[model samples]
Target: MKKIRWLPSQQDSHNRWVVFFSLLMGVLLDSISWSGDWGVAIPDVTPLILLYWVMAIATNNFLVTAFFFGLLHDVLYHTGMGTYALIYCFLLYPMLHLRLQIRNKTLVQMSLFIGVWMLAHQVLVWLITPANHLAMENIAFWFAIPISILLWSFIFLSLRVLRRNMNVR
Candidate 1:
């Protein structure tokens, strides 16, 4: 009797579905708008989710996926085309480059790192979108950094569980 060997591509296909669903959740969360000043404080979920996957899965290049999700966000929010696409791709670059090292960091350390990364994301958005200038001046805009930092553990743990349960490599 011969034993069947599981292929690496099979594992990657499974990982792709898991990654897609998680990123979809991030897009959905990002689409929700709050009223008044509170809206500004809403953390950017997609990028955080992207960051997690980039760190978790070392072999895949999520840049294209990030770009696709960004385009989806643009369409959903009716933003200028490529605004988010560029942001996501640019932000993901560093993560992809340092994913190996980042994977070893403690959650606390990673959260701080995410905070900095997200700050750059915000700054990039501010720079690219002129309409956001006023919002950038608002304290709530800055508040999002802390909010994202707080949510990091939750996102990390939940996704970690999901990845394990789904047997994603």
Candidate 2:
């Protein structure tokens, strides 16, 4: 079996700012958290981006990226402080640890992982949401897990392409 890589893969020689811009795209995408349909729990794009970088790049800086993104996520989305920051870290740590096992897998398999991740996030959100006075009444939130799984391939591909095109580590 291939041993896990705790460090990031080889990176571009220059232009590290591209990585920051790419991550910013994710935080910006979080604005779409709300979907008009009541039955569709929108996939949290920030976590998707966070998981991707933690897995694809495996950089030491990933945690800091997650922290900043998560903080920005909460502020932009108007949720509680440290809410998404904690959630991002929660998902990031595991993905980083498991990256070796799953790195070679196809997107379909990765979607299964994303599905479980989404469920876990929802559970935690349900537990902590009341602190922010948020109500989880929408029937669509139930649909989020499957929707995120189904969309995982697209999201993964898109982010991967962006990462590659930008030559980001």
Give the best candidate by lDDT.
1
| Candidate 1 ranges beyond 4 A from true positions | 1-8
Consecutive 10-residue window with the lowest summed lDDT within model 2: 7-16
TM-score of candidate 2 to 2 decimals: 0.80
In angstroms, the error of model 2 at 8 is 13
Give the 10-residue window scoring lowest on summed lDDT in candidate 1: 3-12
Relative to the true structure, candidate 2 has a C-alpha RMSD (angstroms) of 5.1
Candidate 2 positional error at 64, Å = 1.3
lDDT of 2: 0.73
Top TM-score model: 1
Task: Write out the backbone clash pairs for model 2.
Answer: 39-140
Tens-digit lDDT track for model 2 on 59-149? 4547877888888977886778998788878877888789877768887898998898888877776676564233366656667789889
Global lDDT scores for all candidate models: 0.89, 0.73
- Mind giving the per-residue lDDT tens digits that candidate 1 earns over 1-169? 9977576577788898899999999988988888997798888899999999999988888988999998998887688989999999999999888888877999999999999898998888878877788875697988888999999999999999999999988
